[model samples]
Target chain A: MKKLFAMLTVIALMLGLLAGCASDPKPTKPAGTQGTQAPTGGSGGTAGSEGPSEDKAPIRVGVLAPLTGTMAEFGKTYEVAMSMAAEKVNAEGGINGHELVLEFEDSKGDQNQSAELASKFADDDGIVAILGDFSSGCAMAAAPICDEEEIVLFSPTASNAAFAASSKWAFQIAGLASYEGSYAATYEVGKYAGAHDVAVFYMNTDFGASIVENFRPAAEEAGMNIVFCEGYSDTETDFSALITKAQAANPDHVLIVDQTSISNVINQIRGIGWDVPITMLGPSTSQQVIDLCGENCEDILTTVSVYYSEEDPEAYAFAQEFADRAGFGATVMAGFAYDGVIILSEAIAACGDNITRAAIRDNLAKTDGTYLTGPIKFSEDGDIIRSYLICQIVDGKYVIRCGYDYANE
Target chain B: MSKIKAFVGKHRSLMLTAALVFAIVFPLFGFKKSMVRIFCRILMYFTLAGSLNITNGYSGQTSLGHAGFYCIGAYVMAILTTRFQISFWPVLLLSGIGAAVAGLIISVPTLRLKGIYLSIITLGASEVIRIIALNWEGVTGGSFGIKDIPRPTFFGFTFDSPLKFYYLFLGVAVIFLLISYRLIHSRVGRSWMSIRENELAAKSLGVRTAPAKMMNFAYGAFWAGIIGGIYAVYVQYIDSAVFSLDEGFNIMSMIIIGGQGTLIGPIVGSIVVNGLTELLRPIGVWRFVMYAALIIVMMWFRPQGLMGESNSILAGAKIKMRKAGKTGGKKEAIS
Candidate 1:
């Protein structure tokens, strides 16, 4: 009886494994068409298509996001914002009469998984383009595969200077770290805050390293001295020792470079009763920092590639809808993701009926228009350089202190 | 099923040849490039898990830091190949020797320890290696990692695609298995097994237990390092983040599920685990939960693993015999 039971269990497990593999790839439909009927000759339909038809095949794009690891927050943001963009595109008569579909594969923020998923997407004949893998390291890992496969590897927020340059098929929408870092050092720390000696605490990753590498030369050129610089691992949570070391330097200003742990650093700095002016380079206009740090975030300075203010109706609408879905205020990272989808769809629309991988690449390379994140034009290296807005946390909210043209002034 | 197992046991050599032929021609079946990559991953892990089995399975030494040795080999190849522009063929051997040396150094301190204590020391040692790699900016590139690692070439043919790299991994895996098979059947293998059965008994029998254990560790670490070098070139990128405690645990889990103290255990483990990874891709985060549940089930039903030696000390068969003897004594007394 025990032997028979064991055999039966083995059979059941084998069946479960087969069932898991047998299921078709799950592609997310446009959010607008999930429950409601398809629009027929409506106001949104007038932009491109005559009407939404069920017979036309949907254009699919594979999205590799780290939905289950340390970077899950950013991955979820990409999922929500990209789906929102797909919904908007479909509601506006789809991309050249074909409904836009997104197949989000969770990479868990691992470079191996990212590269494997990229290969899977590249092998599929249905998928025309690939988006995301979150970090620069993961994106760079997948870059070789996408380059060899001749498929478009478009990243929403890979700011590494070497990432886009690694592959001809690779393109990133995030402003280069070199440009952002220099602007932060020269403007935020040097000119705006009038701080001479700066202590920098950056994450130990490609993104953090590149920023500091560029920040040093720019800070020195601006006549500011770097008293101390240190990097901590991404998984590190305790900032007491790091903060103490930085405090020992007794710098006039402190700059923190990281996305997930900005609030932890700020709270720790204030917890130790050190009140040096803190300016951050990453985590642009994040409400989580304010929520987590509370009063400790007061008068904290930062730079953003884009800012959605109540004064702009279009940008404000996006912010409101994003907040309703994401359960937090929208940041510039979300803006980049939303813009990424729309930009890719526009390139797809330009392909007309003969849309191949090469055609998508050609059309995307020629992208030189205004986006949700302001004017975006890919340089020869396939990344963009955008102007910045100086933002300050006042009364527990992000308030823009300078316009996009602040660097020029 | 028993009949089939008996038949296979009778013609073991024939079955082995047939399986080897199938593996060699697998990529030529016109499978998708992604599928080929999955097979490559399986073969890579086959060697990795098999190496771990040398210490944890054969010698009864529990190690949870195989990834530290793996990290050493990968970094050795990446640094030498990228910076010095050395040929990959030589670096591959150097990487293995490097990891073997690291294993020997680690074994020195852990010679007197056993079970969980040795495991804890290995775990700490793995973290120390990763921390050093992360902070050593000059040679290791700090957190930026080493990138653009050149692909290995044989004469003029570059291992550029998944199909080509599949052969490289297969070649290494086959060589490892052949050498391990010879080693496991030799007198040295008998001494290692005796130590696993009882270190005190082995020592009384004039077997050098300490050197045997150290050599076993070095042998295991050597194979891990070789595979790590292959992995560095395969991915063309090396970073400190790749070799974490989680990675060490991942390799260990394969041995647990496939069965330890057996030659074919790791191969079976690799297929089941890597196959499940692809099959469960649609399930998202729940796949990890499923994997944990599968391990729990394996432990409950077959603690020695699928291919682990059932009669070995690691399987607790001696304890079962002792209990049965005690029960029989009680029955005789009652009679």
Candidate 2:
């Protein structure tokens, strides 16, 4: 009886394992099959069936997104926006008559997992290009593997200066933090806010450090004084100590550089009833900041490369579709992710019928077209120099204070 | 099952040879490159868990700050190789020595502490090391971490691919096992085990428990440091985030599940834990839940661990009953 019970337990565990594997959506299978299936059986079926691209094999692109960890929100944005882009491409009669399929594997925001998944993607012969791995650290971890494997790793949000230059195969759509930092210091703080003495509180990561390092020299050149500069760890929640220190400096303005924790810093600063003018470099046009900060976020200055306003109908349409799918209003990250897919597809489409990884990378380097974000042109280092839009939170909404050409002004 | 165990026990050397041969030729099976990477991870963790077992199992030190030694080794390799362009082979040894020295330093202050108190100190030490790695931006590169670490090469052959790394890790794991086997049979090994069995009795038996414990910690830390150096080159990146307190727990979990106090236990633990990680990848965050459940089940059914010594004091069963029986016998004799 004891042996039988043990055997039963083993069987149950095996069944659970099998169930787990079965539940996971396999990468090889076309994700749009269900949507395409109904159309194929209908009036649209005739055109799709008759098209020469129908019989050709689909071009599969692997995506390394942190689907289940701390960065799941950003990863989900990639999944939704990219899938939306793929669906639109398929609707407009696939890439050069070949179906564009994306196989997303979760990296869980861990660099080790990112590297391993990048390797797995590189191993697969069918996958022509790869996308994502979210944060700069994870993207950098996967950079060496992608470089060694001779495959393109296109990230939507990695903004570290060293990332794109780490490997020729690594390409990031997000503008470097250095550029954004300088722009924030010169244009936003130095010119717009006119705050001479500023205190900076940044996250102690690659993204945060790069901004502050660049912001300092620019801030000084713009005749602005950095009264206090400090960095807090990512997991930091209680900002009372840092706030207290910054308050001691008594600067006219405070600049917070972070993504997810921007709202927390604002809340803590406002929670202590310190009403100093606050400007943020990261978390560009993020709705969460306004939503979380409520009335405290009034007149909070930030910057963005692209703002999905109703002024641009095309971008507005994309944002609406993303909102419908993602259940959250579209942010600049979602736009970048959307542009990442469109731009990669354009590169793959430029390859014509002979689509190899090398061909895709070469064509991608030559990308000079305007994307959902802005006019994107990769420099020799495989990253773009993007112009910024100075935005301010007025009555809990991101109102554009300056256009993309504000730097020129 | 009993018959198979008996046959394996009778022909231990033969089984061992067969297993070793299989491991050596396993990568040649034309598996996917990612599968080879997983095998490399298992081999790496095997050495790491084995080293932790030396302190926690043999000497009963329960050092929870193993990641501190690991972080030291990784940073040593990263700084030397990236900054100075030092050769990988010498830096590898240097990394181990660095960690072993750190372990000795940590063990000195906590020589009198035991059980929970010692565990807490180790945990705190691990965090202190990580925080330093995070803040000391000049040497450690702070949160940016040391990236683009050049791969190790042997006589113009680069260990770049996962397949090449598999062999490097395999060679290290085998050497670790062989050395540990010999050391565990030596007088020093016996003294450490005696300390684990009963520290006071070992002291009365003229065994210097303090030095024995210190040596055990250094030996364990040395191997962890070696593995950390290899890992730095393997990932080609070293960061403070990688050596978290959770990582220390991860190594400890492998030991607990695989069975501590035995040479084969760590090897088994590495395989099972890594294998499960791959198998449960599709389950997303639930995989952690599954890991916790497995550990709990292990504790309930086999507290000493799967291959742990059942008769040893670490088992906490027969030894307690024997102590009670001895006390009762003394009372009867007095009556």
Candidate 3:
């Protein structure tokens, strides 16, 4: 009977495999040189070309993200946004008709894979620009490659200040780690309990470490003492021990920095019945986090890249479209990634067909228009000049309460 | 009929010759540039799997730290090429040596443990290396990584293009595979099998178990390092996080799912698993779940894996004939 059941299972699996193979729409192959020539900005050597008369070729832009594995959902949303922009621009006519084709590789959320893809893009793809790498670490690893290759790379969502500060090619769309830290630090620590003391629990990784480095300085300057500062690994599921430590400290407010599976930590903290105001950084307070925390997520404070609830029609529409595509379930990083592609495409269109790595770099440098998030401009190092929004969860949604500009300009 | 069979057996080299000819000609005539990259990935993984095969497949030891060695090799090559401005040929050799030494160190503590314990130790070791890579800002460049590791230049010849790199990787992979194949067929391989099958008996046979085990670890580490160094030169960048525990898991999985302990296993595994991964990516997140399920299922049924220790057709034939005789049924082989 067991053998029979196993045979049946095998048959079922085989059928499923066959169905999957049959469903994939074969990737469209690039036609030969002659086919590509139609409406193409012709190479300068050719007459009556659509593109500018530059000796160089059309710039290739490479996009790397976690196309598969844990971060696949976020990656797909970004790909969709990028595809839409690429399609809309190419339809209206690409940069001086030279055309911009965005190539993608799955980093699988592994730093090694990201580095490998970065190297491959630099070596094989002849890419002139790069836009992606969702995590700060991944982007940090790839930035030097871009600098070496002289490729213009703009990261959409990596928030680590140390990462951005390390390389010249790394321009980030997300606010700096220091920006998030200051935003949290400047908040009235004792507003809820009428006390000015705060406690901190953070992941032991660089993301967590950077927040502490920045937040402590700002908090001290604001005349508030950090009553307790503790760290934990992202892999630990139970926060009971850490929560007890924080509760013992008996501070008026608490700060946490965790990027993976934060729902458990939230629940554990709540289970301990500690009701002090909480502020967390990086990949916290998403819909998924709320789903995992349920009522525990209510009134929780967090920071993210966009404020979709704002009145800007374009931003609202973009958010609505993304929410609709994600079945009304989109993460903040997805929004940032979507806008990043749009910004990149817009810059490419601005550059026209004479697009080189240098041109793309220049286009990004001079960006003045507002994207879905807000007015976007790049500093010399490629970081977006925008403020982060402090949001609170009311009725299980991140409500943008205020904006904090971390650039301090 | 017996004489014909004997003649065929006597000249089995024909099959190998045909396979070699096909491998050489196939990429040149029909495959495009993109296809060539995919094929190159297949070869790279194959070389990686070959290294894993020696440690895990042939020796029956599970290592979750192979990618750590790979990273060590890559960083060494990158530092030598870019910071020291050394040539690729010398740098490549140094990378292998460096990785071999690291493997020796990792294996010493790990050789006493087995199964999950060994896996955890290797995983921890790899993670420790990665953290050091991230935090050691002076030499490792922290997260920014080392960049512009020079491409190969040999005897007035510069290999600058993808096609050139592909050939270079292929040549090096083939050499490593040949070395691996010879090692597996040698007395050392028999010692590994003896230890794997019966450790107590092998010890009684004067196998010098610790040295044998360490040698297996060192050799695996050596080749992984060489492959990694080549990768740095190929990609021209080095990041510490790239050598994390996740990479180690992936290479181990490739070896496991492919036929561990066999030449064709890694090659077949890389294509089947990596290709399916890319193909299923449109489904997005569920693809990983599917892959994990596949590994689980394969383990449940064919614990020996797609290709077992004995790589030859003769070994397979021997098994099939025995099973057929016992069951009194038709024998079938699937590729």
Candidate 4:
């Protein structure tokens, strides 16, 4: 038995050794030389082969997605969305006539792995730009490495302030959490006419503090009464006491100002048989929130910076196509990821033949106008200005209650 | 060939010296920078797993919370050096001591709670530590974390590049290895192992179980914290995010899968597990699934792991054959 165990150990160690040396060492190969388009029949297989793909090497974009762990589901959507973006560019004759290919690297939502992959992408000469990292933590982890190596690290969903503060090369398309909180407040006032009193049960943390601080002024300005306001610590998992306190004042609606704790508060409120309307201030914007809350999620109002509807033909088409490819509904994170690729490719194409990291950065810094998200532009700190939409959970699905009234649109 | 095998086995120091020379000259051969980074990562994990092996693998204590100590060490250095503009040289040992103090705080209370209960206490303590870091926005930077952690310096020269980091990690890892080697063969290590074998029996034999357990806990945590300090400087950023349950599990997996209680096993295991995980990253989300499958298969077939369980087929056979060879004086057949 010991001998067999020793043999297994040897086998496992060999596999590990193999994995260590498994990084791709291939030089940047010109597009249309192998696979996709132009067959080995001497470049006369397809008309599209006549493009610069035959002569120029394809631009490689490193995608740092949480492909395996808690964020694996998000990673799936991101993969489909990014590949969809890549395919769209390839169909449109590729970036600058040189094909664009995405090299996916899984961070597994770990800081260590994210940092390692960041260095790998930075070191790889083929990888001209980087996009992804599902969460803000993962993005910030890799930001310093990319910044040091002069590589552009663009994240569509890393909304943390730390990301921007980490490196000059780091760019996040997701609006800051503080901005999102304030914007949500403005959207709520616009939708509800500010006549009803508001009750807020917020988590006692920087994230929770920011939402209420921003929401208080907006709610007050809109002529809403501050009926009952409370803050709870993260360690206070039992929401019964907080729910009882919230039910006493009985404001027109209650805003659970939290991310992870929102769904808990929602479900607990349902257990008490109080059917007052609820709008989660921050967090629990994920699909899993509905899964957790079930029928209770209905009629719940929430504000989101990322608003995609079937009403918009372009969004509808992309959503439909993405669903067909991935066999799941396109998530908000996935939409941002799709837009992230387009933004990078757009900047690379704009660079012409002088497509360098600094050029990509400069081009991105000057970007403005509508793309996937309307009026997309980067501030000096590399954060995007978002026009938040007022949405309500209707029949287990999101329904827009008002237009994109943010930026007073 | 037979004579050569005997001679080589007798001159083990010569073999080790040659291997050490090979390792020292490896990065100088113009290896890829990315590969060098992976090597440094392996070395870092090597120290982490080796330290974990002290409390978990040797002492028979189940701790799922080394990450807390690791966090304490990193944050202590992050706060002291980055905040106070302190030098990195003394802080390295200070971080270890800081982690040791934290371990003492945990182990003293947890000494009464044996096995799984003790593990749970440690796990809860880790989460509590994380929550404290998350909420205390003033000192620890809260959830945003402390950035710009200065790297270790040597004689006015700062180690910045991957090559420099490789040597730094390697040297530190080697020092820890020597420490573990000496400690494991010492009287205290023997007492700890006896307690592991049977606490009631060791206690009956006049062994101070509490002191032994506490010493083991502190020693393990001390090294874990030192690695954490080095890690903070390596990444140049310290956050509450890094100290997750998954990281603790990852450290445990390194020792368990490689060969717990064996000095060489944890090193091999850390390299394999971390290397395989990193390599599998490009394969999409199935990498973790694959890794899990690998561990499940390993556990099923070899519960003692790669080098752990003694009395297994090869270990027992080698002992039997060696004893026979000694008595028979070259007359006994050896395979």
Number of the predicted model whose DockQ against the real structure is largest: 4
Model 4 chain A: worst 10 consecutive residues (lDDT sum): A36-45
DockQ of prediction 2:
0.30
**How far out, in Å, is residue A377 in model 4?**
1.6
- Give candidate 1 misplaced runs (Cα > 4 Å): A1-51, B317-335
Residues A1-409, candidate 2: write the lDDT tens digits: 3224333444555455445434433454554332212211121112233332666887888888887767888887877777777776767777888877777777878888899889888988888999987888889899988998999999988988888998999999899888889999999998889998999999998888889989999999999899999999889899999999999999999999987788889999999999999998745467777888899999999888888899999999999988877778788888888889889989999999899999999999999988888999999999988898888989888899998777787
- The candidate that wins on TM-score is 1
TM-score of each: 0.93, 0.92, 0.73, 0.87
Two-chain DockQ for each candidate model: 0.34, 0.30, 0.15, 0.37
lDDT of 3 by residue, B1-335 (tens): 34643676577579657766766676675443334555566677778877877787767777887888888888888877877888888888889999899989988987778778987887887787777776665787665567656778989888765466678778887798778767777888778766766678989989988888899999998889899988887656566756767777778787676666677678766766666654564454567788899789766654445554322232345544654675575321211
Q: Model 4: per-residue lDDT, tens digit, A1-409?
A: 4455566557766676655565345563442242221111211112233443667777888878776666676777777787777777776788888877776666777888888888888878888998878777778778878888999999887767667657779898766777766666666743453437778888765457666767788777766777888887754778898788878887877888875567788889898999887887434565667888899888888776665676788877887877776666665666788888888889999999998999998898777868776678888888876776677888888887776754565
Candidate 1 DockQ vs. native:
0.34
Which scores better on TM-score, 2 or 4?
Answer: 2
Chain A only: TM-score per candidate: 0.90, 0.90, 0.78, 0.81
Native contacts recovered, in order, as a fraction for each? 0.34, 0.33, 0.07, 0.36
- Count clashing residue pairs in model 2: 1
What would the per-residue lDDT of candidate 1 be over residues B1-335, giving only the tens digit for each residue? 56765798789899999999989985796777887888899899999999999999888899999999999999999999999999999999999999999999999989999999999999999999998888898998877788899999999999999999999999999999899888878878878888788899999999999999999999999999999899999998778888999899989988887778887889878877877887776566778898999889877777777666655666666534664665442211000
